[model samples]
Structures are given as C-alpha cells and as structure tokens.
Target: MLRDKAVTGMQLTLIIAALLILSSIGYAMGRRRAVAAGRGGALRLHSRPSYHGAYVALWCALPSLLLLVLWSIAEPRLAEWLLIARLPDSIRALDPDRLGLLVLDVKNLAVGNIVSREIDPALQAAAEGYNRFLTLSTAAMVVVAISIGVVGAARAIRGVSPAFRARNQVEKVARNIMLAASIIAVLTTVGIVLSLLFEALRFFDQVPFFDFLFGTRWSPQTALRADQVGASGEFGAVPLFAGTLLITVIAMCVATPVGLFSAIYMSEYAGPRFRATAKPMLEILAGVPTVVYGFFAALTVAPFVRGVGESIGLSVASESALAAGGVMGIMIIPFISSLSDDVMNAVPQSLRDGAYALGATKSETIRQVIFPAALPGIVGGMLLAVSRAIGETMIVVMAAGLAANLTANPLEAVTTVTVQIVTLLVGDQEFDSAKTLAAFALGLVLFTATLALNVVALYVVRKYREKYD
Candidate 1:
C-alpha cells in the first residue's frame, strides 16, 4: 500500500507556484505588448500600463483557478467512486453503512493508516491501483491547468491594443466576483437557519411544542426504556429565558447610565487631550477576552459580592448573577460609550448654537437639541450592548451557576439559554435523545429572541431617525 497525500499536496503547491510565475510573466509581457501597440506613446494608450498588466494577469489566473477549485471539490468523490467500482460484488452487496466502512478501511490501507482489517491480497491490489489513479490525476491536472493558463495569457497578450478597454474588463470581473461572494454569504446564512429550524422541528416531534415553550420544568432526561427508573424529561424554557432577562436587566442597569453619561461628558465637556487619552483607555475594556472576564468574575468579583451580601444580612449564592452581570456590564461599557460619543459628536454644532441663541444654557442645549438628534444612535448602541450581554456565555457559566433558577433577584444562582445549550452538547451526545436535541431548541429560541431585538432596534432607529433628519 502507498500513500500519496503528501505528493498531492506538493503537486497543488507547485501548480499554484507555477500559476503565479505565469501570471507575473503575463503581466510584464502584456504591458510591453500594449506599449508597443501604442508605438511607445503614453497618450496613445486606451488604459494605463498597470491596468493592461492586471487584465492579462487576471485572464491567466482566473480560468485555471476555477478549474483547480472544481477539480479539488470533485477529487475525493471521484476517488471513492473509482474505488467502489474496483471492489468485489460481495463487498458491494453489503449494507450502505458496512460498505462505507469497508471503503474507509481500504482508504486507510491505501494511505498507510493502521487498518484494523487483515492485510489481504485484494486490498494490496486496490491500494496500488488507487495510488496509480491519483498519481495520473495529479499529473493530468498539472498539465491541463498550466496549459490553460498559458493559452489564456497568450490570447490576452495578443488581444492587447491601444483601443482595448482593459480597465473596464478587469473592473467588471472584480464586480462579478464581489457579487458571487455576496450571494454565497446570503446562501450560507439561509442554509444555517434552515438547518437549525429542521433540527428544532425534529426535536418538537418527540416533545410537545406548547409544553416545551410554556412548561416551568426543564429536565431533559428521557427514559431509554419504558420500565427504566427516573426517565421523565421536561423541556420548559421559562427559567432559561427568565434568567437571561434578569441578567440582561441587571447589566443594563449598570451599563446604560454610566456609558451614556461618559459619552455625553466626553463629547460635550472633556478637553481634546483628555478625550483622546481617556477614550482609548475606556475602550480597552471591550478588547479584554470574555474568558478572562469569566475567571475574574469567578475568582474575585463573585467572592466580593457574596461577602458584601452576607455583611448586609442577605444570603447571596456564591455564584450569583449579580457578579456575572456586573462584569458583563463592565465589558460592554465601551460598545455603548464609543457609539454614543460618535453619534453625539455628529450632531450638528449649528443646532447647539440655535439652542444657545434662544438663551438656553449648554446643558439645556445638549438635553434639548443634541440629545434628541442623537437619540436613535444612542438607543442603537444600548440595544447592541443588550444583545452582547444576552449572548455572553462564559461569564454566566462561571459566576451565575448552571442552576437555571427562575428568579428576578440578581443575588441568586441562575443560568441562561447559552449555558444550557453548552451543557447539553458538551460531551458525546446522541442527536436523537431529548437532552441533546434540546440544545437546538434552545438555540432556535435564542435566535428568535436576538432577531426580535434587532427588529425592535431597527424600528426605533427608523422612527427616531426621520424625526431628527
């Protein structure tokens, strides 16, 4: 048995290297050809020499690149098909799963993997043929792709003339590439949403939709057999969402005033030097990793919060939502402050002068004029901060405890939808089990909630935007 994985990788790398060399040559030759066609007069050329060079390079690289991408995608399936065709009737007669395993075993042997199957004469022959096929395929790809690149470069060089719209052609190709990339992005998002929706629907088949939505209990442990003890599962999401709302509210309570006030002061009161120095220092909070915040919350803030609560004769849980929410609030402060500062600064200075012309004070002018104008942006920043708080998992997992207590009290132990999703999918999971499938259900709910927040944010922004604009 022989493995050609390294050979295939080397072949692809060499092909890319060759393509780059050919494209560079095409670039230099195309520029010289265009210059010659224009009789060496810069004014006689239709487009710049650089544009002509780029046009030729694109032609040389694009078609061959497309071919390489298509071949790479199809190569594995083609190899499997060829392997299946060479296998014996008995191997082909096996069930799909067993046949697939046999094919995998053959591939392992062909790739010099430690195969569990006994080394038989048939496998050795198959490995030899597979290696030969791959070797021939690699050689064929190299010859075909290089030949296409060379022919395309030659044609482009021949087509170079003083009247040729090389820039227009290159720009059009770039535009089409951008359009394709945008379409791919949109299709990928749709694919992900549909995947989640279908899996959630599968989960709802075993668990009642109404029960999962409205039931208070959230135990997802289902009995494997009817006679098994302790097999009842509850799919209620009330506690998870409640805890999420509670923590978000606590976070917002801390973030909104402090962030907005800081923004107001920075934009309206602070000197240029102070704003420059303080703004970056403040925003550096946003750059801190959430895991670092998590450990900080778990080790330091959680204990401090507990000690304070006990001193006040209140029984606070060691892992309280207060600690997580406060730390998360600190993390999101920059999001609100930066955006609000920019928005306030964007409010026309003329509006401030108008308010002052009417004998209004600076504070009055800011409150009456600047604030109204920047209300939409400020609200947008707040909503973004809220969304950040909602999606955070590490801080909650560390400091809020995974108890899923449906309480509004910030001092209590609680968990969120994201924590539950991580919990259910942490280890080796059976997709069919209610426990694992519940993660998708929770994910779907979280997506819906986030979508609702975005919709509300859009509505608020639009409604207030017209008023000021």
Candidate 2:
C-alpha cells in the first residue's frame, strides 16, 4: 500500500511537470505562428509575439490547474461516500456514530495504522476496495487534466492571428486575476470580523454586556462541573483595560522622546558616513524576536528595576509593569526612529535651502521647516509604535505578572488584555463556555480599539500633511 501511495504521488508530480513542458511548447509554437502570420512586407500584428505566446501558455496551464484543484478537493469525500455505500448491510445498520468509527477503522487498516477493532474478512476486503478506488481516481485525474491541457493549448495556438488582440485579452485576464485577489483579501477580513462578532455575541448572551464592559474585576475562571468551586466567574474588564492603557502609556513615554531625538540626530546632525553605518544597526532592533525581548525584561530588567526601587525607598514588585513597558519601548524604538528618519529625509531640500537663505541655522531650519514638513509621517510612525506597544504580549507575560490590578502605579505587577486573551484560550477549553468565549469578546474589543486608533491617525495625517510645489 505504501509503495502504491508513493507511485501515485510520483504520477501526480509527473503530470504537473508534463503540463509545464506542454505550456513551453505551446508558447514557442504560438510565437512562431504569429511571426509567420506577419511575414509579408509592411505587415504588422495587433499585439507583440510575446503576448501571443503568453496567451497560449496561460490557456495551456490555467484550466488544467483549476480542474486539478477541484478534483483534489472532491476526491476524498466522494471516495468515502462510495465506500460507505458498498459496506455490508450489517455494518450499515449500525448507528451513525458507530458507523463513522467503523469507516475510520477501515481507513486505518488500509493505511496500515493501528485499528480499534480486530481484523476480519469483511473489513479487509473493504480496505482493499478503498485502496483500489483511490488508485483508479488518481489515474483518471492525471488523464483528464493532461488531456484538457493539450486541447486548450492546441485551440489557443490555432486562434493566433495578426488581428487577434492578444495583448488586450492577456491584460483583461490579468486585471480580472488582480480583482479576484482583492476580493479574496476583503472577504477574508470580513469573515474574520464576522466570526469574532458571532462568538462574542454568544459570550454576551451569558454575561451582561454592560457588566463586561464597565465592571471593575476580571476573573474568567468558570467551573467545568457543577460541584466545582468558583462556578460563578467575574467578567469585569476594567482592570485589563487599565493595565493595557498604563503599559502603553509607559512604553510611549519611553519611546517617543528618545526615538524622535534619535531620528532628528540621524537625519540632520550626523555626517553621511556615520548615518549610513548607524541606520542599519538601529533598524536591526526591530527584527529581534519579541520573545528575546521578553527574556531580557524578565531576567535582566525586572531584577534591576526591583533593586533600584528598593534602594530609592520605593515598593516595586518582582514582576512590575515598568520592566515590561521599558523593554517593549526599547523594542519599538526602531519602528519610530527608522520611519521618522525616512520621513525627515524626504522633506524637500529646497525648503531647507530657503530656511538657510533667510539666515536660519541648520538646527533652526530642521526645527522650523523640515520638522513641519515631515510632521504627518512622523505622527504616523508614532501611531504605529503605539500600536506595536499595545499589541505586545510576551514582554508583559514574562516581566509583568498576570495580576490584573487597577492601579496607576508603574512599579506594581499588572496584566494587559492580550495576556488575558492568551491565558483564557490556552489548553483544552470548551468552546461553548463563557470562559472560552471571553477570548473572542476581548479580541473584538481589541480590534475596535486598534481601528479607532487608525482612524485618529488618519485624521492627524490628513490635517498636518503639507503640499509643496
């Protein structure tokens, strides 16, 4: 059976390779036919030979590929249905659930896997039949796909002529493909939003919407059994919201001034040699994995922060929000600095020259003219950095303890919404339970917050964007 499976796979691969070879042949033939059609003196074709060749090649490959995909999708279900229909009457009389298990056992036996039931003649015969059907289906697929490819190529080659408008047809096909891709992207996003909405609505049915939104406590631990303790869970999300806001604020405070100043220095003050060397090194921070940043926060920064707080007579937890936010800020620095530097560099050189012509120094020109010109992009970068900080999970999980405390103090342990979402959804979870559904509800809220932030950023960009001649 395993050898047969390997042979089947090899056959599919050969079919694909044959189609590619046929497409190449069609391209050459189509180009030659077009050239022959335009051979007379002062003759000109409507489109280039290349377009005609491409048109033929696409026709040769696309229909066959589409058919192969459809066949692959349908083959498994159709085979299973046929196998069930051919099962013995006694087996078919079993309940649906047990019948499903018998079918699974048959498949396992066919694949030489461990099966729940003892082997019998009937099961053995059914497994052999299943394998035979699969082998025949694969053979049929290869034949049909290859035949279609050859016929389509021949038809397309025959259609090639001086006045066929191959370029327009090819471009129309390309445009339709691009439109399909765009629709797919939009539909995927809509599907995600709808899934979240439906699941969150299910969650809201069990928990009051206003309480989930406005209540102060947020312990989402529901009991699995009736006799289990902590059956009633508190669903107030204010503490999670507070922790998210607090950490984001702390991160932005650390990132904004340092990042903006670094951008200014790199763009205006540094010599070309220094800027070129430093810019790539600065951007490398953005590529470092968040988990590494989390490790640094938990092991190095958290202890350092605790020691410093003790020395200064301040109470700091072993896992404080300060450590996580600080590390996250360092991680987000590249996002702001790199983008702001590029935006500042994109400011018109003429504007700088004008400032200098009016007797302004280099620093004054950067401050008064260049900064204003680049303000919109700079703000956009800051917004991106803020989003990155808000969505961060690893740093908070490692350095900041999962204690959802509603406090303004950065020295205390706290947990953010993202951390809770990760916690609630981890491990074996019952999907219908309020505990599991809370993750989707939290996700919906996070999506809404991010969308609102984007809207505000768009407003800021539009309001400050400068137009120059």
In terms of lDDT, the best-performing candidate is 2
Clashing pairs in 2: none
Model 2 poorest ten-residue lDDT run = 1-10
Ten-residue region with minimum lDDT total, candidate 1: 1-10
| Residue-by-residue lDDT tens digits, candidate 2, 110-207 | 88878998999999999999988998999899989989999999999999999999999889989999999999999999999999999999999999
Which ranges in model 2 have alpha carbons more than 4 Å from their true place? Answer: 1-11, 41-43
RMSD of each: 1.9, 2.0
Against the hidden reference, what TM-scores do the models get? 0.95, 0.95
